[model samples]
Target chain A: MASLIPLTAPDDPRIDAYRVIKERDLVGRGGRFIVEGRTVLDVALSPRNRFTLESLLLAESRIEALAPLLAQAPADLPVYTASQAILDGITGFHIHRGLLGIGLRGAEPSMAELIASLPEEALVVVPLGITNHDNVGGIMRNAAAFGADAALFDFASCDPLYRKAIRVSVGGSLMVPFAREGSAEAILDRLAASGFTLIALSPSGASELSTLARPPRAALLLGAEGPGLAPHILARTLTTRIAMAGNFDSLNVATTSGIALHAMRRTQITPA
Target chain B: MASLIPLTAPDDPRIDAYRVIKERDLVGRGGRFIVEGRTVLDVALSPRNRFTLESLLLAESRIEALAPLLAQAPADLPVYTASQAILDGITGFHIHRGLLGIGLRGAEPSMAELIASLPEEALVVVPLGITNHDNVGGIMRNAAAFGADAALFDFASCDPLYRKAIRVSVGGSLMVPFAREGSAEAILDRLAASGFTLIALSPSGASELSTLARPPRAALLLGAEGPGLAPHILARTLTTRIAMAGNFDSLNVATTSGIALHAMRRTQITPA
Candidate 1:
């Protein structure tokens, strides 16, 4: 069992990474990201989790309930306990959920490295120009629910490891494998080289989603809500459309991913 | 054409409804709701819009770009223009989009009236215990995109007209017909009386959503993410589920609705 380390001061350098969470830029702190709340903490503390768990800072009152999960922490993991007031002062806003952790994002595999690591019948979510953290998180949640093997992000997309993104994803970001690599075309090229069918979701696609027969390995391309897939990207990839009623084809990109993934799963080809 | 009336003061009684919007309770003020941004404003200003358009408070700068849509506003509708600083002073936050309007919520139909008004062939969404505005908004968006005839919310559900909800829905809440009335059981009873097939979406459902045969008039039931449809509700309705991989079936209610609506649409039976 992991012992709790009491934190008497808000500015203790020992908990430096946990300080000023609200004002700090979300860019990883020397390759570390923050995980919030109990749900995601379970994922971070799980066996064989891809991301490295460095430490946890939690409200003291929550110790009893979280004791079970904390039992799984590594021997060297530091579990810092603080009063709710101390917790609020350390972080800029009220950490109402009161459970936080510092995690090592580690180095993501390169585009070619990611492709080489994929399983034969892998399903991947390829997001381009996704600026909103919620959209990426929702996509990861759907990816986890639909059994997507991995996700590959283009240059302009937001990091799935963003604090809010991980919280919104309900730890699906941690469960699924992902990497933010080169430009959109470069990532697509690697997927193509790996024999993956590239499906770009657009309103003016050539084939209806329900009727399309999906291949064993496929990459689903998603763009921001309004400016969808770039023209060059759409021209080369198989453009697919979800049949909608009337002129309203404006499904949120995240919701669109759920529908597309479900439809693709219907006719999913099994790998040899 | 809407004639712009310049308002120099933040506390002008004429713009009382738009005051301190951030601090105001979401409860409709004298049966009126607030609409933010130009997109939803368009829906409220339409010729046959059900909601009554009270007035508009624009940041003066936005007035020029919004001329076309403003031209369509009713002759008597007030179009008040103000400096961005004055707009911020009145609303208690930066009106970055610089467009806001007050719309009368009007009288919503009772459960029986809503049921009686359904088209011969209709697709309805029934959301229960949805406290989150984003989830409800996202569900309405999907409802509009997939041609759902109307949506019925149990008493526990939040109002779609909540400021953030309308924004999150991208104005879809204004486009779709919805009624927030009755308890879960009472609403389900009315739908059944109207010859609507009640399909409750649950992870452990009896039939896969893809394989289920939908009827001419169907009502899709959704619940909040964790405490999904109460067991009693599930026992009385035809429980259907979207197929998932492994054990993770925790799809967001809005995402679940999108997938279910898309699947039901595949074999949607039209009116006789």
Candidate 2:
């Protein structure tokens, strides 16, 4: 039987992982990420990821509701139950989902290992500081769906496992292979070295996507909203601008990512 | 001089245009839409769209902030000033943007008229359901940037002008030519009749996008987030698919639109 730790106070040392969530940058800086809501935690706890499982915190009344998942946990994973008020105070944010899990940054894969994992013709989503967590998650979800071998995050992007990002993705973040590599340019270089065409998405580029006679092994590069592909990156990439009808400026980064992947996969014009 | 209408109560008959937003079907049935936030309102007030400026509601304290925009309103438009309490009471949600405007829906031109308003081979975004208002807005923004001539929303889609949709779209909603039309089939028929090859986006279907030899006068068909283009609609037109990396399922609709539009325009690919 798994041991249940009981906490009566919000500030107890046992529940430190759930503290001051509003200060996520500080928390992220410490090299830890919070997996919120029961669904996200449940997926993370699955055997494939084993994920430290650091601790599970839930409202006392709901402990039984999560019994099946709890029982599946490795014996050493700690389970903590606390009052709603205590959980609420400790979380700072509303703990409506009534559950939380903290996981160490698991293992970091090398660039070559990440590249080797991708299939010969891979579509990779390289996100650059597209800070809206939902957008990040949505992009990752699309990346996984459209045959992206993996997702590579540059320095400016948000953490893939942020609670809201994970929720918006419908648990896709956990399922998709992702890494926080340092610079987008460097990642592009690595992809290019591995025979991937770095297709930079921008509004003011010269090539239309339809005319390409052969789809190159490609990496669709996207920048954050407002600040599109950094000039240096754009300069180094094979630029293709998305076609828009009359005066539209740009699609949100996440939406843009989905469209790019779909186009990258086309072979012939089949009449729908 | 613009007159100031003081509305201390939520049910004031003059502000009827801004009521019952939570229930969108009713609003759609009524043949109207909502525009919130100062920036969107400012753009809606532009002479180009010439939106029927019904009234303006400003938090009493924000009057000074809005003085310049007020001066630009048609002389007959009324401005309503209300206390923060009354403003919240009126919108049914917390009024964060501090200013709101009610405008009659812009006069929608007939399909032919809308088409004639643009150049031949213009880009357009055709949204189907796409329930997430933010995605709709994001798509419109992309449409604006990629030079799409207009944004056409299918019958089942959420109102593009809904407060959250417009706010999330970052004012792109107002800058683009947009209107909600009937079913996707009906719209495609109209487009085909006018010489457009409607390219319906799908995950599992014909043709890789990169291999297309020629660009067509086309309309990109996009569906909502999950269950993409219905089989019936997918069967009716030129089904164009993007070739993507293997593991990804699909791109965000807005992204798909942008990428497809970019590809269709052949704006990125250079002659080999």
Top-DockQ structure, candidate number = 1
* Model 1 TM: 0.94
Q: Which prediction has the highest lDDT against the true structure? A: 1
Q: Candidate 1, residues A248-268: lDDT per residue as tens digits?
A: 567889999999988888785
Model 1's chain A TM-score stands at 0.93
Query: Residue by residue across B143-232, what tens digits does model 1's lDDT show?
Result: 878888888999899988887788777777887888888799999888888899889998889998898888888999999988899999
Worst 10 residues of 1 chain A by lDDT: A20-29
Provide the lDDT at B99 for model 2: 79
Q: How far in Å is the alpha carbon of A270 misplaced in model 1? A: 8.5
- lDDT score, candidate 1: 0.84
Off by over 4 Å in 1: A23-25, A270-272, B23-25, B270-272
lDDT of 2 at B178: 74
